[model samples]
Target: MPRDGSATRERILETAERLVIDNGFAATSVDRVIAESHSSKGSFFHHFASKNDLARALVERYAAADVAHLHAALEHARAATDDPAKRVVAFLSYFENDADAIMSAQSSCLYVSILTERDLVLDGTSGQIEEAVVAWRDGFAELLRAALPGRTPAGVDIDVDALSDHVFVTFEGAFLLCRSTGDSGHMHRQLTVLRHLMEALLGAVAATPPRRRRAGTPSRH
Candidate 1:
């Protein structure tokens, strides 16, 4: 593709992403994207074979950037601290600190918007969305395991995987609530709460004594 063609394609993608994030994929149309992007139908079609193709491309681009940020944040957190618990807290704080800016810049999550539409467009993106989510879940779980290297609080066995899922759910739910309430601070507050919860959990592990395993008793890992 020529430099101008590439620029036009990027413009269409940006316009489409903005529209889809704001109004959802179902309501966003090819004509609207073409008009809003200031590109012709010919250019739109030349770039994307169909609306589904556009959606897939959007997901591919969004997922790549999203996962990249996730990885970068975790890497930064790891470098900031040698202690597992502090590293985990640092990771959460990384997002919590920027939640306001992130919320101000984006009205809603693109993945959430796409999922809510429940259209075949999700399939168009292959497994990009799922992979991005998995990356988040797995990344958090790894941090959680590192934080709780031994026995959990008292006799309670914390499920790191489930806790990881909670992180994703909380983050996404914050976006939903923020969008619904039009509260710019909602996401930031939610992230702060999540970070506090993680801190408390870590504190609990530190404060509580680990229960000794009884002889002949089965362990519930």
Candidate 2:
């Protein structure tokens, strides 16, 4: 059986997550969290040493959930097609609707918010969070590489890492723009641009022929 203290701690964390999502870090105070969770100061302190600690936990939880969703989307795309271009389109399209909801709900990019608060979050345990971000990027890169295979434009190498970074930056920028403008239309336009760029990249990769394997090298097949 779980202790009452554990239940109270869970309640506090849940309330904190919602408040942070709805109100942001600066606006959501310990007092607000207490009021929302109906938790006492002693209970809050017992679960979290400080607001920063609670913020860190919130970031970790958010990152984990986001990564899981991303993985599921990528897997669904992967299972649906053998063509790399189609897979890329399917993967990016998964976020088309999600981007709008995310912007509308938070009025800010949660990951971006966490990143901007790195100084506060980096008391000592940012490594895992950093890895989570990198892993998310790498996941996208891997999907792109699998979809494109050895197809590369003549004298123009396709850098999967660079492509992944570009996509990530564009996505972050789109969220910021939407929040700044308080308009969903801006985010929709940005996603359209993102889709266009992805399509162009996939087309370029598909148009190129596979590089020749080295002599005596055995193919995976």
What value does the lDDT take at residue 156 in candidate 2? 75
What does candidate 2's lDDT look like per residue over 5-30, in tens digits? 87887788778877865567787899
The clash tally of candidate 1 reads: 0
Leading candidate by lDDT: 1
| lDDT tens digits, residue span 1-221, model 1 | 57768999889988998999999888998999999999998999998999888988888888877887788668867887788888788877767766766776578878866766555544656467888888999998998887886635678888778899887787788988988898878887898788778888786322112223223221100
For all predicted structures, in order, the TM-scores are: 0.87, 0.78
Stretches of candidate 2 exceeding 4 Å from the true structure:
1-7, 21-27, 149-152, 204-221
What lDDT score goes with residue 82 in model 2?
Answer: 73
Q: Pick the candidate with the highest TM-score.
A: 1
